[model samples]
Target: MIQSVRQTFNQAFSPEHYRAFLDKINADFPGQLDFRVAETPVFVPKVLTDKLLTACNDIVNVITRSDFKTLTEQAIPEGQRVPNEDDHTQFMAVDFAVCTDESGELTPQLIELQGFPSLYGFQPYLADQFRANYPIPENLSHLFSVANNAEYLERLRQMVVGDCNPEEVILLEIYPEQQKTRIDFTLTEKFLGVAAVCLTKIKKEGRALYYEKDGRTIRIRRIYNRLIFDDLQHYPDLKTDFYLTDDVDVEWIGHPNWFFRISKYTLPLLKSPYIPASYFLSDLTDYPADLENYVLKPLFSFAGSGVKLHITSTDLDAIPSEQRSGYLLQRKVTYEPVIQSPDGLVKSEIRMLFIWPKEDERPTLLTNLSRLSRGEMIGVNFNKNKDWVGGTVCFFEQ
Candidate 1:
């Protein structure tokens, strides 16, 4: 974080301007946003930006390990492993808390990493809206390895739709119309020509998958997968012809197996100065004496579900040894409230988004998204009736 940049942005920030920014977003894509947009974009200086990237690379080292798949073989639960997993994930998102170290210097600590797609379709647009609506510094840009938004969208087109006719590549979701992230799906369609197809609507004949659109049935050649099994499990009674575990004929972007392999399950496998001390609950013979400083997280849950901020030895002992493998004990990283808002400082969590083309050796760091929070954690439930706190992008100092 840059103090000077933050000060300048805060001094110039006005509620009226924020109102207009929201209005512009709504006008551009009416009712597409289901989540709150933070009033400001984070101004990250080179020091913290470099640290974030370094932390990402450190975690990626584990994901890219030669035997990563073999090591995480048990991560995929029974009846959950999808068929035809690719050599590597097409997308990865690594989250970090902007924290202070023992020396009181601002540093990044790994929070969670996922081998899944984030708001890739909408982040660039939001970043540009921040630029158009405010006086963002000339030296900062939200993009990486590209010159501008156009180039970024071009790269997205290549990764998501490839050379196939856009209609043949669908952004697959369980129910495209209802997800909170449907805005990104709409934007993806607008920019890349790929339509969002619901799993229920997909008609499967043998190994081939097809979805109806515009009075015609379209064959699916590639799938930009956005559905996760956790959501699908919610509707157990719903019948779908095309199941994720089915060995479909279509290629997958963001294969389902990687979601399990590179999730919280991989935390214990990572060893980095930037990463917090993490261990599988099953492997810990003795619980830490200071259990208050560690967070108990379920290996399979998402969106902060099944996480206990405070725990005791008794709590740890209560879990059956057989079920302990499904949980993780991670040293807590204190979030530093650094972003200077109008009334108070706000803590921020930045998720570094990356894309790995089929031919690439590693994921390429692109733009990033940051969540501002005045509550205990980063989510709508925690930050109720909060301002200057929600989903937003980061402008890294060049």
Candidate 2:
């Protein structure tokens, strides 16, 4: 974080200004902002920015290896494997906790990585709103590898709506309207000309998928997948013509199989200075003496579900032996509360967003989303009743 920029922004900050900023954002898409928006954007200095980039590149090297698919063959759950996976994942979101090392210097520790799409459409829009409302520095920007907002959005459009009519490509989800991140779905439709179609509503005619749009049955040629198997488990009674595992004739912008392959399961396969020690729970014959330094995580859950921060030997024993392989034990990284706020400092997690076109050797880092948390973890429930703890974008020194 840059102290001069922080001081300048703090001097200009006010409750009224934040209220008006929220008003403008809400006005753009009324009643769609279901989550909190932080009062400020993070000002990341060049030093920390370089470290984050290095960590991302290290992880990318492992992912782009020739035998990556073979190495991650078991990552896909038996019944959940989707057909027609692309040559590579179109999207990659890598999360890092702003931490301090033994020398108390700023550093980034890998938290998690997902081969899935993040707030691709909403992040740039949020950054624009932040810039319009705040005095962001001229030398700093939220974009990486891209020049401006138009260029960033254009790259996103090309990846999601490539060579196909936008109408034939839908942002596929289950009960998308009811999802918490529905604001992103609205923005994707606005920016890319694709509609958010729920899985239950999709009609399966033989091997082809179709969805009705304004009294017309439109053929689905591609899907901007936003659905997760964890969320799908919540609706067991609902009947659907098309299932994710079905061999449908369509292209997946973000293939569902990569979601598992590049998730917590892949954390153990990765080796980086920024990456903490991670191991499969099943493979550990003897539990570590300092169990407090580790956290137990389910291999497939999203948004920090089934994560046990405080671990005990008894907790490890409680898991059935056969099910232990579906979990991971990772060393916990101490999140340094670096972002200065009016109330107090808050810990932040920076998620680097990347896009990999089929022709590219690896994914390209585009922009980032940073969350300020005043609680034990970074999420809505943990940061409830807290100020300056919500979703926001980061402005990196250019």
* Shift in Å, residue 319, candidate 2: 1.8
> Over the stretch 243-351, how does candidate 2's per-residue lDDT look in tens digits?
9999989988999998988999899989989999999999999998888999999997889988999989999999999999999999999999999998789999999
lDDT of 1 by residue, 76-132 (tens): 999998988889999999999999888888889999989999999899989888888
Model 1's lDDT to the true fold?
Answer: 0.91
Candidate 2: the clashing residue pairs are none
TM-score of 2: 0.98
- Distance from true location, Cα of 33 in model 1, Å: 0.9
Stretches of candidate 1 exceeding 4 Å from the true structure: none
Supply the global lDDT for candidate 2. Answer: 0.93
In model 1, what are the clashing residue pairs, if there are any? none
